[model samples]
Target chain A: MTEPALGGGGLVDRHVAFVAALRGAGLPVSMAESLDATQAMAAVDLRSREQLRAAYAAAVVKRAAHRATFDRLFDLWWPPAIGDGEPIHDEGSPDAESLEEVEPADLDAIRKMLRDALRDVLLTGDDEALRRLARQAVSGLGRADNQPGRQSWFTYRVLRALSPETLMASLLEAVLAGEERGGLAEKVARQMLTERIRQFEEAVEAEVRRRLAEDRGVEAISKTAVKPLIEQVDFLRASRDEIAELRRKVYPLARRLATRLTAKRRLGRSGRLDVRRTVRASLSSGGVPLTTIHKPHKPHKPELVVLCDVSGSVAAFAHFTVLLAFALREQFAKVRVFAFVDTCDEVTSFFDHGDDVVDALARMSREADVVWFDGHSDYGHSFEVFNQKWSDAVTPKTSLLILGDARNNYRAQSVPALRSIARHARHAFWLNPEPKQYWGSGDSAATAYGDVIPMIECRNAGQLQEFVEAILPI
Target chain B: MPLFTSPDDVRTRLAATGYLADDAIATTVFLADALGKPLLVEGPAGTGKTELAKAVATAADAGLVRLQCYEGLDEARALYEWNYRKQLLRIQAAGDGQKWEETHDDIFSEEFLLPRPLLTAIRQSEPTVLLVDETDKADVEVEGLLLEVLSDFQVTVPELGTIVAIRKPFVVLTSNATRELSEALKRRCLFLHVDYPDAEREKAIVLSRVPEVPAALAEQLVRTVRTLRALELKKAPSIAESIDWARTLVALGLDTLDETVVAQTLGVVLKHASDHTRAAKELGLN
Candidate 1:
């Protein structure tokens, strides 16, 4: 009933209980570290939140192992008494003693429902049916419609939401079940599901590979053999600063073009001076004859042609780049957007003014001619198509932007086609959405492309912003 | 004074008229009494993280203070933004002659400073539950600011220096893992990962949250949600989704989840067309 003592000892008591609660909530908190945290708390001032958090974190969480868990518990246990009444401990409250027991039977039922629902989805190609089934399954288990049990059931939900494992597994189950189901409808569905799932899985794997490369770079920073920590230190600031600066650079370029056009408008290519703007400026200055004059501000409107690789490996990056192109429609006079896997398809007509970026990207992925992307990536075939059908689209004033990972799958790099296009274009810039470190590895044809045209790495949103600045005057 | 009775009696008084005692409720009570520090919970959507925050707030008999984080959120949002115009007017009204020497510091004083959620929580005298909702949605800078305030129960505004809390408020931060928080920020807090409760706990939550609904109907509702969470989809409905799904069924006067009723209410869960088609395929609706 007495007020809890607020001394050096109080800090230890708070953290000890916090760590214990963390352990109880299924986070890994060691006994040794718990003691260390308690000791450290007594030694340090608990008044500063930063100091206390660091001390507790240092004493308890090891590595990145339990960092996330520690963050959650700190918010709940310290300063804020969430999910509990009374800021201070109430020893007399018996409700604070034990945890309620988990029921295994309910969990099993939910698991079974998940399996059945997934099985139905794979067999029938019916998403609505699956949702209905899922709803029924969860409801039967004495839980709410969206809640799944902890443990494996939770895993099942994550797989469903984030990972395509469940859907792929279910599709496989359905395809296999076709032997018993019989006929052409089942056979066609199985074939379609198999092809789609394979493409999806490959795309996911490629993304994982990209992440692995980034992780490798981060790892190399600490090692004695590679770039040191100082080199890595300014990367966060450099990216933001560079993106901002790049936007500024484009503004001047656009202004110059706009001035030249306005000058031409007045002088009519006579190479003589036009005094209209000068006259207007002087009048505004009350006959003081101000030398500085105001000219028309016209935006630099260049012709743009974007060739994006819609191969499964680079599909995610391509979607975003294409969306950027659509968003940048205002600055360009004409924009030609093409998607290629093994062959190219001109999808310039798909974008309309004021179309939602997300909706457009989703539609492009669903409706774009995926024929060039079966299983293998063939840059040779793609380039051949570009030369044969879309050669006339490029012009002297056109800015050609090619976005891809540049993995040609050991096929011909088709440098001749790219060179031909570069001949007509003002500048041919290859924006590879892959790390510069991964430029030459494996099937990547980035090195070959880099030799012919200027290639810049465009990965993540920060890089995308930089790319936008480089291409368009904002 | 209340007599010491059975555990059920204590739970009933805590529940008060139709609420059921669940694991989260039990854990909150136990931890608040045992540890004396606030509990922070992180989880995927629909995992009862926010609900736990609310429940704890209710149990403590303290007012709940929430701060919702988002992109481009600045210090003025989480802490305080000064009433510059008012201060300027005050400076003007006090006459320019004596103001420079006597009231130079007064214009930028605490009177002109408006307290934000973080600062307000510190200043409030009554017990309060401060919920920093969706902390991950906030930028890394905001997260850093949060670490400074949550750890100390005080805010340091350069103009005002340090302002300590009269009473420490209960704190809970929830995240959906939008981005990785800095280790510096994470180090200052205890962490709890709340996933979707197991079927038993989920049942308890459903019943406790929606006691007016029939028990049979509640079980059916829980079972259906468990099943839906198994399929691959863009938007996996959360515990909130589950509650809505149950309510939808209850509104339709359906005792059980049938295929017909599900088709009619499919919009409540699967949002995307592809998601719907994919879910339907797996559930064998087509």
Candidate 2:
């Protein structure tokens, strides 16, 4: 029942600072949750870092999406120090000289030694040796002289130099030696080898980050090393790896959005008369309707008409928008997806009932009548074409969503064409994948469009989700 | 007030029931028990979310009341509901002389009250573990009901009155992250994310669950299951499935996990045809 005073009164300050760091990383840590975290930290053995780590994670994190960020921030704030004091290596400590003497300068020799040590760790499951090897790999191969803001780069160097991925086959072969061609065994061994390699890489990365935190202070190291959650990464600027991660998140995002929309729909209930049920129930109340129960309202799913600018720069944004709308097609009464470049075309037919999404996107790009005169993004001309072809597209029941950067190539922005569609639609919103500050710059027809339709700067999946929720009618 | 003496006690008790608790789990469980807050466990499917609730019930030697949530799960199913059919029959049986208030009072009495999982858990004076399984699968409105029940450990029927818990039950909610739970509900609970256990822990689990399986065979089976989990399969082999695989190996008296043995018994682990094909291709099995 007694709260553990973590190292004599430092736990309070440490916990507060750690929480502030988590909040800074975009994980919402409310005041009540912070108190819960403090209590959780008090409940555990304060000396055990893992116990405290679990405590903070269980208390502060409300969902699974924030766990990775929580972990990274936890590491930065509550670092694993060697002793009572933080492991500060200033004034030419023997750590440098001893590391140099123990580790070889030759990359090839260090690699060989790493391969052998890693093999031993994997085979024997020696966690102690693995941690030592991670440190060794960083000191020998990564080898940076306390450079500011270079921990990730150093970690990358260590992983590349060690190349544990290449050591997978050899390690597996070594572990399962003389055990014949066991197809499943070899396969499991290979994956196990891969798993160990990943662990080593993670350890080295964590080690480098820890050292940098010890040297440069947690604040400085944290800002540079901790990656923003993948959902927070900007769509226009996300790397291929980040994009792949974002792709994996698409279905879950769609499901959550659907759940919320369903909830929202349920809240906006207006029951209609079901005379059969009402009259049938009235017989029990002596021919008098006491409750007057109306029919359960059939959800009035809205119609959606999406015009996506699938051109050069905004293609990734459009791709995501289209895929999201595709996943949420059931929520809408009808969804007519139109893709455009210099010209416009309704690609709704491209997304057939059972077709693969990636193939459909590819076929839509290849076959759709999106290009009339040139390959340049002529949003003005595209808008006119859409206005001409799909005159009946935007009914009063429809919510119109336009996805683009609004870069009209200095061409005539046919504002009236979009204005006509917006006037007919129940709701209209334009999602610009650029920052709002850059909206009215250069050939952007953002302001012109903004006069007609509400333009939202949706830079990432997170922002996209927020914008979608807003557009869904109550 | 403590269900467990310490974090070590949590580990020991949970381990005695064939459920291993790492320091993190032990600490979180201990804190949840000490603070008298509901514990919310989130994870991928088959990582033992449901089993954790069961194991904690065993550890605490309490009665387990489980609410398996799904879409359209309403208050009538989750909480208390009046026996409407019985109420209707009672209303019909009450002839013209019966007063409205009298019939209403009789129908709303304890004899006519249908107590669901939530109401049952709250009404328990004995030690109890209330499990809301797959909490994310339930509709959002259900969460508002849960928030009220969990925060105060009480339920109200308008006809009768609010009934508070004599002894506060240990509450555990598990979710597969199908949808994000409301913040109001999450705020009342301590969160725990249980991921797939590492190879060593999984091997130990397999050994404990199916002791007839050899140590060497258990190791191989765990490694293989881990590999399948690492693959981009439709449904990865879960801890429970891994235990089943171990039992299958034991029953077959297969000690060595070799090419022929695995080829014959691959069905024991992977269920999906596509997963089988993909595993064969990825693992380079002829």
Candidate 3:
């Protein structure tokens, strides 16, 4: 029942460190919030760790996404001391007795045992036997040392012990050895076995990580341990693998953005009753006000015109920008997408065919005549094409979004064409994938365009998300 | 000046009004009351964000001033607005006797001012709970108005002077986190997130709320709900839905939550057609 060493001064110091840890985990905790939390701690009893943790969380954490990290840091600082007295087992450590019990020979025996068990399950389609074998594989091969980076090692060992390749090979042999009529059934059984084995492998991996999280803390688990890597990936310099990963995350990001925009739009519709209008209308019936009219606050969903530079220099940046625009197309009243390098062409039909963005981008690259397949980017020529043919598309209700590096290859700046488009559109914003210091260097004409349209630096997903949230009508 | 002296006091008082607050909830509520700052509660829908406000109001024996925030929630609707009709009538009744300047000041007086929930809560002599539900649904511009009111506990009317609170009301703003709130507004408040309760807590909730239901049935119902939540359904069942499911079981005179009974009453828990099909299939009800 005694207090754990923390007097009045130490309590404030502990709270300060907890706040620092939350900020380290990427939650923005300002000095004012830290002061508020210290005051909140003073109001609560430090004897109760739960009370102190709640007070600090209530004062410091703002976003729901930061709650998990806050909880982890809180538990680390204020380890519960009461009824939950279970010591850290450290059974997964190399020096532990459990490691000696799981010898290399036992692992080899487990691999063979798993292959035979899976072969029997595949032949008989026994669900119970498959579950039992999955459990055994996890227990036998999922042991780990105290090393922080050994989680994946254990995962790889478990999957290797399951021996999905040998199981598949055996199934193929059985299928080919059977008679022609029975061969078809054996093939179907082999496909089913392949799926079940894949599930079994995943189950073992999940069980190992779950146990490790219990022993070494959830922060030790790799996937959830690291913050999203895509958020920090530079858009302009992203490799093909990084681009693919970013593309996979784009739809979910777009969906979340769209949901917020939709909620704001829906809520804009209903406000207080328009009493003046209702009273005016009720004068015909002796001012009874039979039906009331609420004030209309419907938001105008702006028409979007996306001009993406698909030249070889910024093709990766354009790909992601175009994908995001099309993913969020439903939030706009109308969307027109154009890709340009040396000439401009309306590529809106690429997105209109209801295909996935990746497939649509692939098709646009193959068939769209917007770019002459020239490696050089000429802003003047593309702007001339847009001004000559697509000038009518830039109405006052449209939001013109230009995505490019704004490098002009030292060609004509075409400031007038951009100025005219900005004048015609409701709002014109240029999102440059390049950093700000390089905006006016070399052949980049970003400074000239900035004089015409406000340019925003969007070098990664985080900046791009901020721009979208700011521009989307709320 | 604190409403509750301790966290235990918050728990006991809130429990008297049918709210079973955990240690976290109780502590946060108590600290917010003590600090006299607005409590910003964010969570998934039906996780007792709004219920916390109601319970606090009941426990404090205070009048509840409810303001439902949405897009286009301006100062006129949220804080205060001049009664235009009454003002016009006053102008016509003046009969051209007074000067225009004199009459202008008269029409913008206290009698012509209509107080909204924000103003009403501040002007009250007695303690009150101001519930601003779904604050994130309101426009970003409305956050400006909230910041003005929450920071100084006052409203500025250009026609008149600023109206400060005679007695500061306890404020609770709930959001589903549809959008990120401005940092300036968030800094002026205390934050709480009410997630889905764990199985043991949820079971205790069912037992307390639906007391007529047997202990065994309540445990079974909570287990089924936990399993249903683990499935990737369109919408997960909330704490309110769990309570409703428990009530439905008790009302049907069923003492046991067997597979068939749960299958028949799944509608009370799963609202969507897709969720029903998925839960039934996953539970092997088919």
Candidate 4:
């Protein structure tokens, strides 16, 4: 809409691919945004990759939470292979690349030489040198295995080899070489030095991932390396960033799911007749019963009871499901969120303080009494605890949602306890984050639990979306 | 003429207004100008989302019309509303038995229409910057109203047909991400996320805004603010707050930011009592 494209077909192709990657990562980049991205790229200085990065980010990234994912994917796609056109390809073996840096030195000799060079670069704050050192460091130390088709690359080994912490002593000595032991300059220098070191650590991580991505293709590496699009990411395996992203999308997801539920429970409500309008119409009809006028009807909403297993691997899943349910609380008459480990406790009070879900979740873990006897999940004990504590929470008007994997930790199964609770509620369903095939595995009572309530696989947000439609209406 | 010719042009112009635009900001601003589209700027509070709009308005030497959104904001407050009292008085005075249809048309004319910020921006012949500030705070219904006016650069008054823009004002909408704005609204604009500047850019901002402060002191202040930001506080000190801190240091004639100075002037950068305590505890000031 702005102007015709200025770049060649190559740039347009790259942009389309990048946009596809972004969309697959769960960013809602629309047609107009993609067009704006193309137009934005045409307007910016293409020679500078940072400028191009900013342009694409401005055009595509809608939320702050998605920016980290965008940046990671952007690096993989458009990589800063700038100035130094392409990375040096190893001739003989992948491990032979670092040997080119020195005369076939041993591990200790390489560390000593690399450390000396790193200290100088870090002291001078040279970014280019740091990146170069990152490549060398990864090639030298980041080899976890030599197996083909397996991504054995790890950032930890490289960081461990560099041991940037050991370099900190010398760094502080140089920055505070002649100055007082502790002064304003020292405080400032320490903070700056700490950040620089962290950046170096990130550089090593990025280098390792990039090399892995280059070797095994971006799509394959992205499965293990990059955080998948928020919806496709398993709740059990989601990173902190993905969980935060899920939290941000919870409301919009709720709105979409609510629209779906509205279509299913489209009950026409007949409101109270307006007496003034009805009587005025009756006077025209010789004081007899005639036309009617009704006030706007208030539709009866459902109440929600979320019994979440806030323990072990299922914590993220339970938290997100509870958050999604509570986001739709306006559509519900009441929302009561319960948390359980070995026992049960009502954690609904944690969510009462406005929409600060992060703070509420933090407080729920710290303050809520969800643990009793060894913190191991006991499904039977928790059900009995819930029955004893809040049996009245599940009424005929309520929709009961049990969020757990039903692993049961090889403990006793309380099918009767869950069955009684399910019978009380208008609609009851169990959301197991584990896959369907893993239901009857060792230590997992999911198959047994499925007998009492319909256990559905909700491993990811996409599956949860379907389960949400199933459990919303009576 | 376009507001900006290129991304560099945006940087140069915005810098002159004492607002530094990084590559992303410069590129996004220029695109927003060249495309004649609204710019949706979202970020954490105090990252200078609002300041970007003001800087553009300053750079273009145009009028800045801000529609400060909040709960209970209605069409009468946002778009054009009829002057009901003036219309009623006109009806009472014209008791000479004018036709009802003629009176009805007369009451709804442009003469009785009161243009709010949105309409005011549209009707201006001169260049204007329409800032829909903290848009997420407003009810979702208001977005529907914004969609019609923004998409066509026109407003429909039933009394009078559609009123198109004499000159399309540069639109900038800022959000703190309290809620997600609909995709339809996001689609119409260029999206930009403004985050905290790096240490170097922040120092430049401090020196540009407060030229009175020494460069070394400005560096120290930016470093301290960055450290404070790293701490988990309820509200972090924004770029504007850092500038204010610089001005404070200059006023106090401080050459260096030692522990003594920072502890004493902590309140200058931190407002919340709890935040002060947290910062003090974290920095080991106590």
Candidate 5:
């Protein structure tokens, strides 16, 4: 492909294409914004790539969540190919000599070599020596000529070369042979050797993966490198790492919402002329108009009661939703959070004294009076308990938020309990992390609960944010 | 006269006013001034959204008209309101001498009108900077009011007729991205998102704002702040707060940002107690 020209006209065309690419990536960019970006580009110094990228980002990208996608697309569009030449040099052939050195004829010789390399290092706990041996084993055993998709093959070979299993066998053999005979030294040495062997295997595997990544072209690696952006990640299917990332993003999201809410609250007073006061003051000036008075508009701070299902299936969603609600506690006059699995319990006090939502959730799961360690999720029972014990918590002024999958495990779903709560609350909403397709599937009472409370599909952070902004008192 | 001739000019002028403008910010500000379009700046708090408007006002030697937006913000507060007491006085004064038509005309004249920030900015004949701080905080209805002033730089009073701008003011609207602003409002303005500065730029900011801060200490402070930001804290220290931290360190006679000093003075950078405990734990202070 021909490189786009770097002049004004060329840059504008490149920008248009770049915007198209952004749009293809699911980022919203209007034609007007594209034109504004073209105008913004003129004021930016084309010589500096960082400046150009920032200018485009500022002019085009709207939401923070889209930034990662924007950056990736920017790099692809503007390759930055000048000074940064291709650095990956293909090692055409694996060194035969090093391969032969590691390929011993007998398992005995392999065992001897492993023992020699690790014995002293394990006894003395020398991390540097252990690392060097790991690198040597990885290079010696990991053949570079393996097929493109055989990365696991290299990792397996490197692990076998380190021979953690063999090392464990030898250590066991030594201990059984009574080398240190019932002494604490023997026990400690055995423990140290076991830990060191595991580390050695892990290091060798990591080295192999690093080399494999290098073997692939930059484009291939980058394609896999771009994570499912947080906004798009399905909360129901998110991994532990993705969930952690989502948790980190929650605070900033809540803070932005809070700032907007606070600004709204501060501006809550209407500027309608207080005619009564204005007229009363005019009387002092002999009924002549002098100063106009404005009535201060007092914003109603909604009382929030969040009912979250903290069961195994929907705990991740509950964790994030609860964290966001607590973070925005200032926007409401009162906020009460309840977590339930089979039994319902008020967990608002856990967050009352601390800002660590995760820590508080952990404490609630372990020590809260309402939680039972049993894994079953009974929405009917939980709602019944809530109605019997905490019915007074929901008032006509309260905005009741229920965060759960509404899975009743094919048990009784007391829709009346939910209806009563909804009747007492000003507004009630159920945010289900499950997609709409799965809403009424096996064990899901979402359809039944839907009749009493409106259920919003909140399968991701983006949807959750939209729900919050929509429901938040203006 | 245009406030900025080019992007570089924007940077230099803004830097002269003690506010460091990044390339994106400089370019956006320059284009906004050149095109006479309102600039919509959205970012996290303490990233210098409001400061940019102040810098532009200083650089152009223009009068700064600020309207702090919030929910329930009405046109009367943002635009103009007739001085009721003054109008009443005029009506009482003209009661016997003039007809109802003449008195009604007199009450709605310029003398009886109290101009708010939007109207004041439009009325200024000289160079002026109009800052609508935290526009996202205002109700959605406020965006409708702003659309008229921003699009045509004019306001219409029922009795007085449409009053167009004598000299269009440099308009800057800031938001914390609290809520998605109306699409129509976003379309009328040039958008800019001013995120936290990078390490090198942050160091420059600290040095410029708090000159008394030693260079080495400032670097350490900025590094710590960056590290703190990486943690999942409720509120990360903004650049302004980072500068304040550097100043705090200088004033306390602490030449270094060792663990103890940081542990003690982290409050300057981190506002929440939970944040303090978390940072202290992360830094191995406890």
Candidate 6:
């Protein structure tokens, strides 16, 4: 495809350049967004500030988390006009601030001022002074204005001016480089960065604590057990020990359940005498009939293979279900575990005997992109990956347990993969973490998969355990 | 880096990023700090509650330790679990009665205590921000466990006794309010309910977050998301959703929040096929 000409009845190439620069300078701009920004620029006149503002807004950002970063990048991308960009008002300004104020720079003073300024702006909605202060603070970095590489220098200065983390990182790098100047520069820088980082962290922690403190309505998990006389289902809180005991008790029951479920036997008419069956058969046998005893049949436990999604939205549920599957490996002759976000990995090797399930999960999470967004959920790619690498593991005696939110993000659903796996497996069970009512909405392909096999709603541990009890056997 | 003089200064920051909320954001920020507790923000599905946690993390320059809570979360799952290998080795090496105290202590030691999100937050010496996310979906017992931890910053094990947090861990808990948390836990900390911001606030939020986003387009995007949120969607668009949606549109080279662009990028905000179908039908994208 031919490239669209710059400034030819479209957004100027400079605008795209500005976006690229913004992204390279640490702004999180996607390619799709760059295109949006370009188109937006074309729709609005650059000279008109209002129009320019509207176009930019339309092209980028959707959430509150990105506001400050976007604002900083925006200023850097489109520096204020000369008329609007009055020189820094502080004594620290490039042209006016004394070398003393700029030279023996108090990192703490700068940080405190920045924090107070930020909090003030957030509280009052006026940032003229803060902006001026930011500009002035940049001068203290000793960046020469009007140089060819001045943009990066300016960007760094601004980044340092705004973010205490950036400032601390830069200060540490400077100290490591052995910049011994201004007598106590090194000490001051270290102290300032440390204090600022601390304060910044406290600010964050405080916010979290506030949320945890709030009146979040809670509910009890219902139980099916009851006191002696009558059986009843009631809501109650189960202690950790209670849950553990349940796990221990249920495992044996699961084996018994397996035996009952597959309790079918055939006996031969000749062999060692069968006390019950042979005697009963002899009653129906001919006058001089001899009966043969046959070997009793026992149900073989089905092997299990679980494919779980650990993407940004579904990792929490996946963690629980995956751990449960790992714990129950003893019941089945062979059990395999796999985790996926946009792709799949068989992480069963991590869970050997005596392994801490939590540690194994944590290790896997650290190495894996549990929260990384692959732009889209490509079900096709995940299935293809599994088919190419792990399909052989599944057999006619194996049960496949698939768990996720199943929002495919409009990518290829790869229905054929599920079908193929289902065909080979003894039984296929799709467990959805979300409320059943939310099924069939948005980009979810659950219903599509539901067409192939029974998809059950498994929301809590009780339900999960019951499902396992019902299906984990032959 | 950008500078804001006050919380009000965040208005422009929010506007620049196409965010819509302007009302009581400072109140939310203040309660979080003044209470010396993490803020448990409850909101609708598509509002910016999660983004708020992320924003606070960014603004404060703290390490964001997030624990995405869900069903079947247990003590070992949420707080800590023993590292069996390490425990076994210690047990094997000791193999004697005189080392009883040492062996007992070894199991309860921080080394053996596999720090989940809960323990990790409490153990962090540095200024740490912990996000116990989506508390609604977690079982009531899990919430109770969270309450116990949040109230005292300690975990009690019969073998180890109670391990208290040496450093005060900043906690931020968010919920879609899918289910309510118990009153016992709520009474111990501060509460903030975040809702979708108004048009003006959203405009400001968007501008602040995505400065390169064209002003017209940003405003239009904010308006579009706001409109979508108002609609009867199975999954409403949150601030995070809007941000992703806008970013996706931008990446696709769309200048305006038109129906075509919305259709292509709908997956970001709406996860269900039916939700998309319903939204498209209602919004006239079809």
Give per-residue lDDT, candidate 4, residue A330.
Answer: 76
Predicted model with the maximum DockQ: 2
Candidate ranking under DockQ, highest first, comes to: 2, 4, 3, 5, 1, 6
- DockQ comparison, 2 vs 4, better candidate: 2
**Candidate 3 C-alpha lDDT tens digits along B19-89:** 89998899999999999999999987888999999999999999999999976688889988888778778
- TM-score (0 to 1) of chain B, per candidate? 0.86, 0.94, 0.97, 0.96, 0.97, 0.80
**Residue B282 shift from truth in candidate 4, angstroms:** 5.0
Query: How would you order the candidates by TM-score, starting with the best?
Result: 2, 4, 5, 3, 1, 6
Compose the digit string of candidate 6's lDDT tens values, residues A1-474. Answer: 112211122235546655655454344566665665555455443554434543454345432233434444444334332211343333244423332353344756654555554444333333344444443444333243464633212334434446645444545665436654432233333443454444444333322222111211000100111111100111123344333333333333344333333321122122344577666666543323454555354436788888878765666556666766765666678878877777777877776553544456667766654333453555656776787788887899888888887888888888898788778888888988777888879988889988986899876565776687677553
- What's the TM for model 1? 0.51
Question: What does candidate 4's lDDT look like per residue over A206-245, in tens digits?
Answer: 8777777666666665545555567888998888867877
Model 1 Cα displacement at A386 (Å)? 1.8
Compose the digit string of candidate 2's lDDT tens values, residues B39-145. 99998778888888899999989999999998879998999887777888899999999899988778889999899999999989889999999998888889999
Best by TM-score: 2
Please give, for residues B178-232, the per-residue lDDT of candidate 4 as tens digits.
6668888988888888888988899999999899999988977998998887665
Every candidate's TM-score, chain A alone: 0.48, 0.81, 0.57, 0.66, 0.64, 0.41
Residue pairs that clash (backbone atoms under 3 angstroms), model 2: none
* Residue pair clashes in candidate 3: none
> Candidate 4's chain A scores what TM-score?
0.66
| Fnat by candidate, in order | 0.00, 0.73, 0.49, 0.47, 0.37, 0.00
C-alpha local distance difference test of each model? 0.59, 0.81, 0.78, 0.81, 0.77, 0.58
Q: What is the interface RMSD of each candidate, in Å?
A: 16.0, 3.0, 9.5, 7.3, 10.0, 27.6
DockQ of each: 0.04, 0.51, 0.22, 0.32, 0.19, 0.01
Report the C-alpha lDDT of model 3 over A268-380, residue by residue, as the tens digit.
Answer: 65767998999998885557786688886666789999998998778888888887887788778999998988888888998784455555788888888776546578888
